[model samples]
Target: MKWQNALKDYQLYLKIERGLSENSIENYSRDVKKLMVYLESHNIDEAPTTITTEIIQGFIYSISKSVNARSQSRIISGLRSFFSYLVFEDYMTSNPLELIESPKIGRKLPDTLSENEINDIINAIDLSKPEGERNRAILETLYGCGLRVSELINLKISDLFFNEGFIRVTGKGDKQRFVPIIDVTQKYINIYRNEIRNHLNIQAGFEDTLFLNRRGKQLTRAMIFTIIKQLAEKIGLKKNISPHTFRHSFATHLLENKADLRSIQLMLGHESITTTEIYVHLDKSHLTNVVEEFHPRRQSLKK
Candidate 1:
């Protein structure tokens, strides 16, 4: 089969069968496109079905020189998924990537902001500007809800269930979950809504969108990044941080405070408890505390 046809079919399967989000589908497709580009540039005439492991290996080797190990591993994983799809469809008898292994890499821990640092960043916002209240609310929501930047921007006014003490979040793959919203977070959001958002001449389609730009349209992902970056610079924060850092901080803080991993996993909308386990590595002291507080042997010794 033609490379283009195979990729097109794979994209459809990812969307319909795997239920991947558009962003995820794009990332997966890009990996295949990179291989296609490599093939064309090298004048290698090979169909998707006929492409050998050696050619794929050569492409990976060439890419390793230009990209980091993490990126290289992701590309390999993406290609492996694509080939596995082909095998499932009977396009190939065996997967070419079955024998290939992703590069061994260390588990890079996420960066987290201390409670004081987070407060400093929020405090640094200039309340004089028209968007200042909105910005503060945005930061509060980010740290408070531990939302992905995409989820935060796409949040709608109707999603707020304050009386019920929850906000419905649509996470990756359009999966919805209700996350508990604290009173402080609700107060800041209410301030922005009443004082700032209420005054904007909101565009027709974005009427329900929670966060809007000065033009009264939905905020872009880059806008969120820019906002946080400027805030970090203003506060003289030494560590590099992004919107995701707030999420990491939320999980790490919860773990440090003796919050159960399973609950954090549910709140974070992680599919696996393994994903939430990374926070355990962030604070070994929390684990020690758990043993000291609940271990029968420790309790007996204390008695």
Candidate 2:
């Protein structure tokens, strides 16, 4: 098979067979495509079924000079998945990636906004323009639904279930879940949709998309990032923040307000509770209060 065709099939396998979301499939595809681009540019023709580990290793080594360790690591992971898919389909007898090692890296915690800071950031947006209303709604959904940037970009108008007070979110792996929506968030979204989005000449394929660009096409991921970045600048908050700050703030604020970790995990669409446990760390006051209230002898004495 041609390398391009093999890459496409591998992507489909990852999606349909492995049940990965579009965003994840894109990342995996991007990693594999880097190798394709490298091979093409160098006039080195090798089919996916015949490529060896040495070629991959050398390509990685050549690219390492220009890219950061984190990006390089992600590319390696993507390549490994591609080879594993080949093994799964019996096209390859063994996985060449089994012996390759990923660079070890420490987990970095993302920055989160305080509830007040989030409120202030929203207040900073000038809602006079048509895009302003949409921007406000975007921030609401990002914080309220705790959606990833990709999920936000692809969110469908049909996904809103306001009558049920829930929104159907398509998360990583194209996994769908019904997350409860706050009334305040729904109100802003409807305002933008009815007042602004209703008048726009929407594109054919993206008719059901929630957020849109001026051309009435679906908003790009970079545009969303740019929106958030500009809002951060206006508010004059100096911490390094991204669209993910809203998601982290959503989880952190919930945990601080005594929301259950399991519930937060379900809302965030985390497959493992361990991933959600990062937000479960209690503040000193809560820890002290728990100690004072739950101590058996102290409770008996107080009564």
Candidate 3:
């Protein structure tokens, strides 16, 4: 089969069968495309079904010089999934990547902002500008709710249940969860809606979108990054940060302040408790507190 045809079929499988979001489908497809590019540049004529482990290994070796181990591992994983799909469909007898192993790498901790730094970043916004209120609300919601950038951008006005103190979030794989919203965040959103968003000449189909560009269309992920970058620069923050940093900080701060992991996992819309456990590594003090507060040995000693 042609490489492009296989890729198109794989994309459909990811979307229809796996129920992956467009962003995830694009990432998986891009990995396959990279391998296709390498094959073309080297004049290596091979089809997906005919490609050998040796050729794939060579492709990995070639990319090793350009990308870090973590990235190479992800590409390997993506390709592995693609071939596994083919094998499942009876196009191949065995998966070529079955014997390959990912590179051993340390678990990189996420960057987090302290309450002071977060306050400073928010305070740096130029409230005199028309977009200032909107920007402030955007930052507040991001930090307050621990939202992913995609979730924040696609947030809908209809999703807000302020009286119920929860906002509905659509997370990875189109899964939905209700996350509690604080009164302060609600106030800021109300300001933005009443003062700014309500005035926009909203484009068709964007009327329910909570955040909008000046053009009254939904905000892009890049725009969210740019906003955070400028805020960090304005406040002279030395640590590199993006929209996800707020999410990390939210989870870390909650853990430090004695919030339960199960509660945090639900709020963050993490399908697995393991995914939420990364925040546990961010605060050594929380670990100490846990031992002191609940460890049977420690409790007996106190008694």
Candidate 4:
């Protein structure tokens, strides 16, 4: 079997069997292609099933000059997944990357905004402006639903099942989940739709799109960032915030308010509970209170 055909089949497997998003599939394919190029340059030709660990190590060494440990780590993981799929399909008897060690990199926490800071930023919006209502709704939805900016921008009007207190979110890999929407957020979205969105002449193929620019086109990722940046600037906040700040704030606030970790994991669409553990850093007072009030070992013998 040709290497090219194997790569093609692998791409399909990632999309259909593994159920990765388009962006994720592209990244994995790029990583494998890089390996293929490296082997070609060294006058070594091998199909997917014939690849060796030494060649993989050589490829890592070649890229080490220009890539950082974190990025190299990601590429190594991608290649490992590709080869593992080959073994799963019986194309190979052993995994080439099984013994490969990924470089150690400490977990980097994402930037978060305090609830008060988020409120101050949203309060700074110029409500009299044409985009004010839209911005208000955008900010509310971002925090209320803990949505990724991509999911927020591509959000559809029909996807808002507000009457049922839920919105259908299309997350990574096109996985769909029902996220609860509070009445307050529902009110803001309704106001924006009736009072602001109702006036715009929406573009074709975007009539169902929840948010639109002045030109009636769908909002781009950059536009979403720009909106958040402007709000942060207006409030004189300096935390290097982004559209994702709202998401972080949502999770942080929920944890602070005593929400369950498992529920937060599901709401955030995280693949693992470990990913949701970062929010634990956002609040420790609850734990302190619990320990002070309920720990029997610490209770006084007189009591």
List, residue by residue over 1-303, the lDDT tens digit for candidate 1: 999999999999999999898899999999999999999999999999988899989999999999999999999999999999999999998888888889999999999999999999999999999899999999999999989998999999999999999999999988999999999999999999999999999999999999999999999999999999999999899999999999999999999888999999999999999999999999999988998899999999987
Which stretches of candidate 4 lie above 4 Å from their native place?
Answer: 1-3, 234-236, 284-286, 293-303
Better of 2 and 4 by TM-score: 4
Candidate 3 residue-wise lDDT, 79-112, digit = tens: 9999999999899999999988888888889999
Candidate 4 lDDT over 67-109, as tens digits, reads 9999899999999998998999999998888999988998777
Identify the candidate with maximal TM-score: 1
Q: Which pairs of residues collide in candidate 4?
A: none
Each model's lDDT comes to: 0.95, 0.87, 0.95, 0.88
Task: Return the clash pairs for model 2, or none.
Answer: 21-173
Candidate 4 differs from the real structure by a C-alpha RMSD in angstroms, to one decimal, of 2.5
On lDDT, who's better, 1 or 4? 1
The candidate 1 region of ten consecutive residues with least summed lDDT is: 93-102
True-structure lDDT of candidate 2: 0.87
Clashing pairs counted in every model: 0, 1, 0, 0
